[model samples]
Target: MLRTLWKHVAADLTLAAPLLRLHFHDCFVRGCDASVLLDSTANNTAEKDSPPDLTLGGFNVIDEIKTELEKACPGVVSCADIVALAARDSVSFQYKRLLWKVLLGRRDGTISRASEVIANLPPPYFNFTQLKQSFSSKGLTVHDLVVLSGAHTIGNSHCPSFDNRLYNFTGKGDQDPSLSPPYAAYLKTQCKSLSDDTTQLEMDPGSSLSFDNHYYKLLLQHEGLFESDAALLTHKTSLNEVKKMLISRNFFAEFGQSMRRMGNVQVLTGTEGEIRKKCSVVN
Candidate 1:
């Protein structure tokens, strides 16, 4: 079913990034429990409705996969597992082969809250210290932070996500010194202002649709789109890793390892959570 879906929907290339973002956002907030997939109730808001998650797409792809899974084996697969698989398979589009194995057996969480989104997931403007704390809080290492960030190689971020660097870096109408001046000038043209939320910019610039080491290459040039991307250079260890990844042929393997580690963050298992019949709601 995923093979068929890939031929149709994933062929567009744009959808792959959202699917990857969905998995990261979902895992970071509630430990890959698919809590991010839950729809908000009249009385309760979910992570899906949060400002940070408002840009997340590819839900239809997940729903289609779940529909097919339900037809073949009712109540057997968990939405959590589906999310993990989709994230892994989405990366396969670039390399034309699977990057890593997604260990399943995860179950969906019963609760989803918009309030948790901001506190858990690191924002685009996070500095190096803040990014480190965020990742460490989830049991991920600095290596994981630098590696998983490579996912930015294929995604589109809204103007609001990084316009601060382009327009007002320190609130004095100054640009961030860390940003490449020419790149920042180009970004100003694309983003216009912080209020321009509707415009989307390629996170990897020039190669947003392809997953490759070009992101790190650009990061070394200080052309990284977000403050968070530039933040990788603020530390010695992460800076070294970024340089290594720029020319490393083993990037795919390292990325797969880091992703597998990320997929294991604070996860619920062994009857801890339920296998939701529908991804968007509790059974």
Candidate 2:
């Protein structure tokens, strides 16, 4: 089913990381109830409108898939399940293999307030200790933090996310001491205009589109695009996990495990929540 749906998507090369991120944002706030897909109403703003979630993609793809599923099976499927499936399918597209199997039966929540986004979704500038606390708030472990950071192996970022690293790391107008010198210079050229929201910087340099261990490899060189990525090296636990994945061929297995754990965050099942007719609005 996913293979057939993949053929119709426009940006085939991308979408994996965004779908995964959408799920992350959804789960972190109010559980994975498809709340991230809610559209803003006149009375209130939606989570999608929040600053941290502003760059989130794959909404249209999920909506299209929901429309098709509703036509085929009525109310049998949930938007939350569709997103989880889409995330797994998107990753499989790049890996050319299955990474994880998603569990269904998740329901959609009707609430989406933009005000709740930033508090739940931490910024890229977060340091190691901060990132650790952020993940811990969601019931994710230090190991999960390092493993899921591997998703940076794919996807691009808006220039503002890490421009401070390239232009002004310290108040003295110097680049971040933690970032690689040559890589920082390269980023300066790529992000000449710090305010350019249209410009994108690849999270993973050579293998940005591939779901591999390249993210860990780059962090070892201090070429990570965000302070959060570099933070993995600051602590003993996260650093060991990074090095473990770097040398072990079973990174895929560990990633799958961590993702499954992450996906289960505050989930609503059984009699909780409602199944929406459309992903963009409440029924």
Candidate 3:
């Protein structure tokens, strides 16, 4: 019945679209630990990898929902479990469909660092080799790499996150000619204003809140926003697999399975971690 309770909690949390989007952004960048949601502390500033103060607007929404759940179910549920369940459910609800199973019993991680965020999360401009290496360090495979990239379907990137991809098209240094002309034009327009608000670039223009196969379709159309995303179509090891997934339903099904595997990687459980009272600022 834990799985059923988990699903109900997830569905309830999905009512907040903003939190759902933030969850996707965090998980896609650094697995599904909610570490990206942690705030910075003076003590952790000197750490090797400190996470940014992204100002998770949805955090309060999550807390409110969790409080309600606790009163209804007592201590039967955990905050960490709620975060994970909500994340998966948000994707499914936003897309209007369900795909994979999310295992429960994951404990919240007590430690969060900014330097680690910089080192672990893939930059928007990384090449296929760099992407493969980054995921490999986390013990994920090529298939996991492509499937997780699908998370881009729901989140948005700031101009600072993807500005280099535009105005710099050199195949060698910063420009990636693999980005389609229409796609590049869209990014240029999106980032034209120098305001921080201008950095808001949607991953899937077709369906921003959905989690279907739109990401694969975007890659096929050469409309992927990031250099790393476009690189999938040009890289030898990943190109064919990406193409196959885009055109075949069976391939998309396997891609979903791969995502379930990626989500469950090396998670801390039992008494291994702590649930922070604040997701942004670490305790």
Cα RMSDs of all predictions?
A: 1.1, 1.5, 4.7
Please tell me which predicted candidate would have the highest lDDT against the true structure: 1
Model 1 lDDT at residue 5: 54
- C-alpha lDDT values of all predictions: 0.88, 0.85, 0.62
From the highest TM-score down, the ranking of the candidates is 1, 2, 3
Error of 2 at 90 (Å): 0.7
**Candidate 1, residue 172: CA error in Å?**
0.5
Judging by TM-score against the true structure, name the best candidate: 1
Q: Residues 244-281, candidate 1: write the lDDT tens digits.
A: 88775767879999988889987888889898899999
Per-residue accuracy of model 3 over 4-93 as CA lDDT, tens digit each? 434543655323345544544454444556665565566664212333335234565556655677567765455555666566555565
Residue pairs of candidate 2 with colliding backbone atoms: none
Q: Given candidate 1, what's the lDDT at residue 112? A: 98
Off by over 4 Å in 1: none
For model 2, the superposed segments whose C-alpha errors exceed 4 Å read 9-11
lDDT of 1 at 59: 89
